[model samples]
Target: MVLTLTTFLLTLLSIPLLQKLYTLFYNAFLHPLRTFPGPPYVWTDWYKCYNDVYLNRNWTDVLKELHEKYGDVVRVGANELHFSNPSVYNDLYSPTHRWDKDGALYRVFNQDESSFGYLTYREAKARKDILAPLFSHRATCEMQGIVKKHLDRMCEALGKREESSDMLFALRSFSLDCITTYCFAKDVHASSAEDFKHPLVEAMDAAVPAIRVLQYFNPWRKLVFGLPPWLAKLTDPNAGARVELQDMLLEQVKEFVEDPKRMEQTSNPTIYHRLLDPSNGPVPSLKSLHDEAMSLFFGGAESSGNVSMLGTWYILQNPSIESRLREELREAWPDLEDMPRLEDLEKLPYLTAVIKESLRLSPSVPVPLPRVVPPQGATLSNHPIPGGTIVGMSLRFVHQSEEIFPDPQTFNPDRWLGPDASSLNKWLVAFSKGPTNCIGQNLAMCELYMAFAALFRRFELVLDGTRSEDLTYSEGFLPFFNPRHMRAFCRPVEA
Candidate 1:
């Protein structure tokens, strides 16, 4: 009886000591991110990160708040750090010396082994080497006629829509049609009077929201993909949607392979032709080709579409800026019937400023792309961040910095005009910097300039019921301004 009583006494005495041990373990070994100063719960739980991202909440705003409390650089997670100082751009994203693109998040986004967007850095470099010539100025100049045909179709569709119809929906369909035509050598005609009924379009729309969820709560991708098909669907809605999309894409590719003649007939000497021809070098396997086609199709459609839509929305909201932009277009081209050449568009100062301002205000790629620290560790703002750390610079934070851009919230295109505009232009890292930056940036710019100049010159846009500042943004793999929530009233301009 005496021995049992002694054992009970020892057990009771050890509870506080065990609690202290647990805390020590968390601080020293188990918690690799403990040194970062973020929200109290962020270190202990990842759900905190998801909650902020999933709701379309600006985590950059949270980072700014932390920076206010912790200074220019702060540890925001156990193994994550954020640097708001613009100087960090040189260290983080500069071409001469920069981190590689093997981050866990990037790997998760790669849909297949053969997918161009999913390839490793070395493989990507190789792919870029092969593909670079296709996107060159010479190539774009050759393809201008093909692009213009689609833009003409888009303008006709816009003309038929009720004056106040959602331009966002119109732009989405236009971009999808343009991209799919470029990829498949055929028109999906998603922007036409007949609504889009294509299986691919339906499957892609369903997949986007699911992909966003996956991105926010990154799971063990291999384990997730390894599960039984039914079990995987039950656990991950994105997996099901992805499967459906992949099947449709594969079928489309099979059709192309079966009828090489069809591809030849429809081909306009595009990137698709280059990718399919062995003479062009390293033609991907059928599966890889499908993955790449889908990647290019979706990336081109979504990113460019969102930017064009937002640029339109921003111009509509700021009338003075819009008027100035219209004046510039008028002065440069003067004839709406004859489309401005690429060289002509380049010389329009106010048009370029308006585009710059739009990109600054509503960046389609708003989030900071995460980069893994190198083996030797890295320095940001003179602070030594340990190796294996996940570091990023938020576009939202950098573009909106009061130091870099005074009156940052206002849509002021004038900031990009005049002599001092050169200084301000240096900080506009919308497409990011370095070799890993967007490959389709030039194409995107050309499309935007054409679409904006065409639409604004033909129609006058007015906000129907939505206020510019109050417009909602849909959060997913990429954030797009919610068009369903925005109602714009348009009226034809007198020629």
Candidate 2:
């Protein structure tokens, strides 16, 4: 009886072991990507899990090293390949490709019905069309007042700081406030929080790092997101904000779905007007409404805030750069009381160059936006990849390319000033390229432009012992900068 029991246990375990072995064998020898080269265990998805989950190293940084060792293309997962060549970016992510986004990375967000979370080209395109009217350039131009109001409130807080204020948190607060008001007619009022330590902003900062955990072990995402507010607060008090926001969004979605006409009661023309309009098409499910709300908030706030923060830091560090920028701003608006319009700001060549450089240098959404090759298969870097292969190229590969942006590390706005600058515009993939690119970029651009104009023009900034490494971040879906953020003393100027 003892021998039989032992034998049963062995059989049960060996079956899976044998299955794993066969998978490894097939991936190593018979898989479509078999010819691709990477380190051992690359045949298993766990190779990424080990690097991203176990070792907790930056996956993009690891890919950079792998590319250096294995040449331009490296097989990073069983059916996944990553390219380090800048030229391959356009070829793989062409406007016409209409490739599906890889689900492994996107589904972790837990908003699959929303535009950013949609995997198929058709689904995403449909949502994008419905929402395009609200995010059009003209819409953004008209809503400049809302952007400026939040910017003014943020700067007012900075001006009142006793010693120093964190630009990252402050900028993120401004963004969160702007997005909530602009999109939902909900004023989260994150900007009013003392020292910019609002619970939602803190929760968001914490959440960015946690995304690494969700990426490799997605099942845990449901568990993590499913926690009750009290339990979440017990886990981490800041997490309470995340849970609270989820509940609020759920309630708001239900309200709008039940009475679409009630949108007229909102403080502004909220996204509900577009999303719930019958003429646009059928209304989405309740869950989709909530998902779209979260998607728009995150999409609007995070990168814009981070990029503007980057611009502020870079400008403060270089006195000459700041001087040149201030000289231009002063000449453009000699009286501090008379601020220029968004249209006027857009026409400032130096300011435009500075904004472009800021977008170029900031590790805006640093990770690769993964997309699946179509079922018919596709060519990347002139190599034929299988239909189901996962392919991506990090923006770092393109933005920091020395061949394209010389002295890429330096914060020189002059790069965007040259006669050849127009030719380089194709490589500026900050908003990304193609149909699935960021839909709310118009609003984000307006925010970025207004942030720079207001801050540099309204006050003189002095860094408070923030070193270069303080700005450095590890790779998550977003770059995770923590333990230290850029702090500055904002002294209001009267000219």
Candidate 3:
């Protein structure tokens, strides 16, 4: 009887192990992607996580090496294939292809209800359609004042700083304020914090790496993010600001939803106006509003700040680049008091080149935007990829390809100014392409222009011991810079 009972317990445990063994064998020898080449461990499910989370490697860098070894298409997981050839990028992300977003990669953000987090193109489109008007070029042009208001606030704060400011935090703070105010008519005042150490900014800084780790244990993400404000604060005291900001957004969303007439009282039209309007579609649930607010706020702040910070970092390394940028800004504006219109700013060839080069060199969403092949399968790079296979090609592959951009690592804006520069737009997939591209792109473009122009035109900038080493980053949903952040002195130019 004792022996029989022990066998039953052992059998229950071994069942899961046996299932894993069968999966390994099937994935290695009998699965549809069996012909694809990868490291033997790719047959196992946890290898990418091992490389990304456990071994602590930059996953994209690893993909570069693996592509070198195994050619353009490599099976990176049991059902995942990562493509390195830039040719496949256009094919996968083209407007004609409306494949669902790969759930495995996107679920990390835990924003399933937001436009970005919606899996199917149809679902994403519904949300994007409602949100689209607010991000249109016309709308962005009209809303440039909102961006400048926050920029002015940031510059004022910078003027008061007695020492070098944290450029990352400063830019992030500016972006946070812009997004919060622009989206909800609420000023987070992230830029108003002393020396740019806003708690919300700090919490975001703290949250990025944990987000990278959360990929491995997806279910744990719920546990981590679901923690109550007090419990989250108790668990990680720095989370107080993050939780506070989230709670504030939730309250605002709640207030708007419960009494949507409050949207009429806002200084500007908020997302709540469109989202809650019955004509556009059914109003998203309160929880979904909370999710969308967090998604847009964090994504807007992080991406804009990262691109601007990276551009400034590289410019400080190349004084010629900075000189040319300042010269163009000075010419375009003529007087510091009278700034160029967003349209005029877009027309400045050199400024446009600088911005394009910045976007190309440092893609904000550099991760492999994975897409699942449909049930009927698909053809890419002349290879017939199997149905339901999770396939992705990272923007890093497209942006850094030597064939497309010679000497891709160098910060040379001239690349975008060449005679054939008109043709390079297809290769520039920074905001991505297709039906589900970034919904906030026009707004982001507006923010980048304002941020970069202000950084160069309004101040005489100097790096404060921030070297190239400090800018190295590991890939998550976004790039997570390591060791330290970019710091600089922003002495106001005497107009």
- Residue 329 lDDT in candidate 2: 93
lDDT per residue for candidate 2 within 323-350, as digits (tens), equals 9999999999888777898899999999
Best by lDDT: 2
Q: Backbone clash tally for model 2?
A: 0
Compose the digit string of candidate 1's lDDT tens values, residues 125-204: 66666667766767766666666788887777666667565666566666776666655666766666443323444445
Error of 3 at 408 (Å): 0.9
Error of 1 at 312 (Å): 2.2
Measured against the true structure, the TM-scores of the candidates, in listed sequence, are 0.83, 0.97, 0.97
Q: Model 3, residue 348: what's the lDDT? A: 81
Looking at candidate 3, the ten consecutive residues that score lowest on lDDT are: 475-484
Worst 10 residues of 2 by lDDT: 474-483
The residue pairs in collision within model 2 are: none
Off by over 4 Å in 1: 1-36, 45-50, 53-56, 110-116, 193-207, 220-248, 252-263, 276-281
Stretch of 10 with least lDDT, candidate 1: 194-203
Best first by lDDT, ranked: 2, 3, 1
